[model samples]
Target: MPDPVLLVLDTAPSPRLGRLTGRVDVRHADASSLAGLLPAADVLLVWDAASDAVRAAWPGPGRRPGWVHTAGVRVDRVLCPELAASDTVLTNARGVFERPVAEYVAGLVLAFAKDLPGAPELRGRARHREVQQVAGARAVVVGAGPVGREITRLLHGLGVRVALVGRTARRTIHGAADLDRLAARADWVIAAVPLTDATRGMFDRRFFGLLQPSARFISVGPVACVVRSGLQDALERRWFAGAALDVSEGEPPGPDGPSRDVPGLLLSPYPSGATVGWRDRLGEQFVALYEQWARGEPLPNVVDKERGYVPSADLPGGAGPDPGTGPRVNGSAAPPG
Candidate 1:
């Protein structure tokens, strides 16, 4: 019953929840301030799932909620020794973000290809140079998750041949063994991989060295995917073309900082999936999932604590997290075909 489903979530930016008035018992509380309220709810809506609070306080005195859902992508914050071992059925807003983020990656690739962000001011006639075309560029999208796959599909739409890599080798998808070879030939290296123990700081020197001087790197996942030191090396040496990151090892790149001084790096405060309809879709996801949960139906987009996410069952529903590259953050963007 909606009454038992304590919607213990941070307030959202969507007007869509205006319709869910008396159907559910919604308790709005910030993560830090949820000391006394969590135990009463049967299900807690962890809208801000990235917070340490979810993991810090769990199974509260044998009164924790039976189910918990996060609004964003990447459950690195959600899964841990205690939480994963519990009977709580963990699910995420997987279908909400894949395409929107794919669209964002496409935009960044186009921007870099054309130098749209920091172009040499077209007005002044002091220096007129030739503009380059992006038609024949090679783009490598890391991670074979939904988000990465979506990025690959979008790049392919632009005529860029994309090679996909996943954890295990399979038909049509490359495994870790093939990454370096793929990176070597790419004109654009997109980091759409997840943040697992195997992938943290995975974007180090060797990966950067593989890129051509003309290749750009775009990250739409956790910052930890790209080591800060390695990125600095590539920028300084111009080892590759440039980079546009939606996620970073250290975000809000310190004012008057290295990212600002870097020649070709275009850094923003991680806004890849901060678009319209995002919050509404999150609320919509909750509404739909609750419908299924109440009916005792098996929940879709379940998170596998061991592997982090349940593998994709069909073409549309596996391992999608938004960084929601903002709405949902990373992982899911558009499902990889």
Candidate 2:
């Protein structure tokens, strides 16, 4: 029997797969070549998590890979109707990013609370101003998956009172039903949910309007969850104290992009989950999962295609299934939950 073909959607500084040598027939493809190669492969590895090539080419005529895996936590880039409805199993790199993203959120919370961004200006003017304390502050963290749980744990250590919200109300976690109420009273509102049909544009005008004016909003999840214009309006109108985002809608916004002019807004190019050696970690993770698949064992991090994320129930410390907020695409409208 021929070795099963493993097709890699290539990216710069490609994943080191030396260990798989002589065990499988490895192939490579760029966006332009992926469709032509899909029919011949038994497994697909999406190395470039940010590329939309998978979604674009997945529907083409072919017998798709039996299994597909992305090196990113979120599956939005690779999801399409055809793939979702197909029999292929989808997996993601989940565990690798949880701790890094949680730590990044903790750092952002501290920075905002202590007014760390203003330190340079204060030094220049030789002025002194009191900063807020993170202790005793109230926070509503949306998402109950591994990433969300990690954020909740770290925030608890900082003495912050965190309301961890999941899809449904559980023993210690709040449900999507309580989001508005919790957010309205929170000192910080953090979005950590995946991008799904329900959460795509959940943080829009109405949602922002529910926040306390002194509260700060931070998104560590898919950027499409936020409506750019809605957030800009809220910041301009002082509906909230400030906001920070780790991800951007498409490419990182340019210097002249609309986000640049938005007051009290901080933007980073989706680095929350990217610690040093993250790529290597991703590569190593894929190899491990691939081995499991080859042995016919159940693979972890299997994404719930219809829901667009790995169900929290499948993860250690997962709060539960995440019932998303509302259904809306980016910049569109959805009825209030």
Candidate 3:
């Protein structure tokens, strides 16, 4: 039998897969050429985690690779009904991004608190602003995954009181039921949750309305549920202090683009996970996983395809099986357990 074929959805700064060059039939394809290469492959590595190529071209059931791995934690880009229902084992780069993303959130909190970015821009116009102290701020971080935990850890290090919200309540973590209560008391609201059906539009009008007027909202991941018009309306009415979005609904405009026109809205092309030497780390991580795959060992970071993320139970410090907030997975609430 020939070597197992490895197909990669290539992007700029391609993963350095030299470690697998002689061991497998490694193939590379851009979005335009991906579908043509899916059938014969044994494994598919989604190197371009941000691209939707896989979602558009996932060959159904028997036609796809036996395993598919996304190089990022969120599998939203590649998740489709056909693939989710298939036997394919889906995995992600869970640990690789956690700390970097956490650091990004911390940096943003500091920048906002100290008025660093705003001060510089204001200084250009001979304006000076008072900076707030971060030592006593309170934060509510949605999503208790590795990324969320890391964010909580770093925020705590900075003396910020953090309340973590997961799908279910666990020791020291709040469930969805408590989000509104926590949001109303928080000074910072950070969204680090995965994009799923339940969480897709979670930060809607009602969610935003629950926040304190002095709170700053930061979305470190997809802004799936944050309706643009709702946010605009909130800003018009000065509902909250300000908002920052690393990811948006549509293609983000280029530098100095029209997205800057929105008052109290700060947008940055998603770079939370692109810290120094991150690519090298990603390449090393893939190589390690590739070795495990070659040895037929259980792969880590296996995503719960149905949930569109690595289930909480699979995470290192995650909550138990989702209690579905109100109680049962079914629509009925669990009897006062």
Q: Candidate 2 on 1-337: residue-level lDDT in tens?
A: 9999999997664556877889989999999999889889999998888888998888454577999999888788899989999989999998889888888889989998888887777745645567899998999889877777778777877888888887777666677899999999999998988888888889999999999999999988877888888999999999999998885334467643337668899876557788888889998998999899999999998888887887665344232222232111111111112
The TM-score values for the models, in the order shown, are 0.85, 0.90, 0.88
Q: What are the per-residue Cα lDDT tens digits for candidate 3 across 152-262? A: 777877888788787777665777788889999999999888877777767877778888898998887776646666776777678998888775323455442225567
Q: What overall lDDT goes with each candidate model?
A: 0.70, 0.81, 0.76
In candidate 3, stretches whose alpha carbon ends up further than 4 angstroms from where it belongs are: 13-15, 124-129, 248-251, 254-258, 317-337
Candidate 2 RMSD to the real structure: 5.8
RMSD of each: 5.6, 5.8, 5.7
Q: Estimate candidate 2's alpha-carbon lDDT, on a 0 to 1 scale.
A: 0.81
Error of 3 at 236 (Å): 2.3
Clashing pairs in 3: 201-225
Candidate 1 residues 1-337, lDDT tens each? 2365465567453455555567767677676666567777777777765565777667544777788888777777777677788888888877667787888888888877666775667676545555567777776677776677667666776777677777655655666788888889887888877677778888888878888988888878877677877888888898987887774322456652335667777765545675776777888888788878877899888887777764564545323322323112123222221
> How many Å off is the CA of 74 in candidate 3?
1.9
Ranking by TM-score: 2, 3, 1
Task: Give the range of the ten consecutive residues with the poorest summed lDDT in model 1.
Answer: 326-335
